[model samples]
Target chain A: MTGRGDGIRPRPDAAAAYGAMLAEQLRQGGLAEPRVRVVVADLLDHVRTTGEDPVQAFGQPADYARAWVRPLSRWRVLGRAVATAVGAVGMFAAVTAFFRGGSWSARMSVTIGDLVVLAVFALGAGVLPWTLELWLGHRAARRVGRRPRVPDVVIRAGVMLLVLGLLFTVFTAFDPEVWEPVVLGPPRPVVFVVGMVVAAVLSMVRQPRSPALPRLPGTPERWWERTPGRPGRRRR
Target chain B: MIVAVVVAREDRESQWLKGVLDLAVLAALVREGSAYGYGLLRSLAEAGLTGLKGGTLYPLLGRLEDDGLVRSEWVTGSSGPPRRYFFVTAAGRAELEAGRAGWGAFAARMSTALEG
Candidate 1:
């Protein structure tokens, strides 16, 4: 089984990719790397003996990683809760400031209608991208037959857009007269466009490169059966 | 249609395997005294429990270790890379015994029910 050309020679690249992925997961899960290395070595031995493609045999690297980091989900949930709370507070302050003509110490005398409009804009600006990302991630996981680990750059961009849009909205609400000069000012649009384009390019560059596998034809039942929350099986 | 049926059956089997897998791994370690991941998996397969994926097994081992039911150590092979050998702890052995007893009783009850 160990002989070269005996159809069982280990694929070094695949083993390396698997090792890197496992290591990242272990790190994320706060496991000791030395301990994980022992397991990785053993798994590599299995790969050598069977000559099976690791991804095909074990499922997507991200999904495999996630299985080990199930405990991290609680922290993720807690973090999201904290973020939403902080965002709400910030949105309230921003909206209030906007209503007071961008004056921080202005009187809290805005009408209920004004408050409602600000709340709507704030929610739309802050929550829409996040909801969209989650929905897209769920859809991709089901359709692609693998877990969708959204890239960090994409996440950062979404956050940046959320913040920028919120700022723009608050500025407009503060005083429509002053808003145009600050946000849609002569050089601001050009800067925003350039920043967005650069961010998109960087995100594309940072995405993991993998050999594209052919997509299989999906049956209606299978499509419906694939719930976003369900862990996927290793597709051969 | 045939493919769909086979896929569904595999899905069901995988879910069933997940439930019994911890028992199987613990039993394998207890029987073997100590074994590395791949070697242990091969032993299980030889005993007729094949198709266990690495993704499934490694995390389970990690969890078992975390739960203090198993312990692992790195030992260098004479000719190749170091391997993590896992051994069943005393707690693990006790757990395995309890699990076996429970499973035996459950199986007997199910057998009687089905026979009826």
Candidate 2:
């Protein structure tokens, strides 16, 4: 069958559109033809209302898992590692201070900080499995476009890590005998500033190209026409 | 009168050809063994099925493959881009012969009906 000039038809590269059309054609030939008609109608509805390629819409869950979920998960792991390293150093400091006849309160406080850092690190580390599951699951779904069963093992593992991190933080914060420090070394201003700069640069790097201005699918353009109101006159 | 008869004959054949094309494509693959998409499309056009677009042909090939009547494999052409080539299966060949028989029966019945 030939394509009608219905705007609802997907522009060929949209794989989901291609799949839906194929499904309709096969079902019509072999099984109930009305079933194919209903599917085609639904597909047309999806296209007309959303202006989204249906396949791509189904792919949003995978995309979200990729661009946001996996990254956040990994960053949380990295945070845990940073906390652990800092805590380990605090532990060493506590031990040294204690040996040096440091005040009971001061040495004890550093020891507590060490414990806090380690706990956070341990909790954060558990997120790795969940991150891995999300990544692999998304990749598989993209290839086949079939519903994938989310592994309970991965989910439980992720929950376990989060709980562990929370428990550590709670215990450290609430303990009575473990003395808490008034300040933890220079307020971490340098780390915060550096982190903000790095975060800004990363955000800038990962920004999605606006899809409003359609580019050739899966290919780059030779020249870009800058939208009006942008800096600098158009250059060849 | 002769010119009018020729024109009428051409119109009837064109109308008949249009309906048979969907089957004609299946017959070509069943007979030819294998064909590249563009090559098959061009050949069909040369045989009088004209105005077929690249967009229409590619999707049809994909649908045929999906249905298992046709199978495709990607091969890198000398041009360096991969093109999907299609060949009919045993079932497809059987279906083509059945369709051909059905077409002949239908044509005979229609001719008798029209004459009556």
- Which candidate should be chosen as best, given DockQ against the real structure? 1
Best by TM-score: 1
Off by over 4 Å in 2: A1-236, B1-20
Interface RMSD of each: 7.5, 15.6
Question: lDDT tens digits, residues B13-110, model 2?
Answer: 87887566656677767545676654565567666777554434444554455566787665554653344457887777776788789999998998
Model 1 alpha-carbon miss at residue A94, Å: 26
lDDT of 2 at B111: 92
lDDT digits (tens) for residues A1-236 of candidate 2 = 11123345455445443434333222212222232332233333334333445555334323312211122344644553444344434444434443545343332233455556545553443333334433453344355445457665676677778777877677767766554653343223343444344333322121111112122222333343222121211111
Which residues of candidate 1, in runs, are more than 4 Å off? A1-7, A25-45, A48-50, A70-236, B1-6
True contacts kept of 2: 0.00
Reference contacts recovered by each candidate, as fractions? 0.43, 0.00
Per-candidate alpha-carbon RMSD to the true structure:
13.3, 19.1
- Report the lDDT of model 2 for residue B96: 74
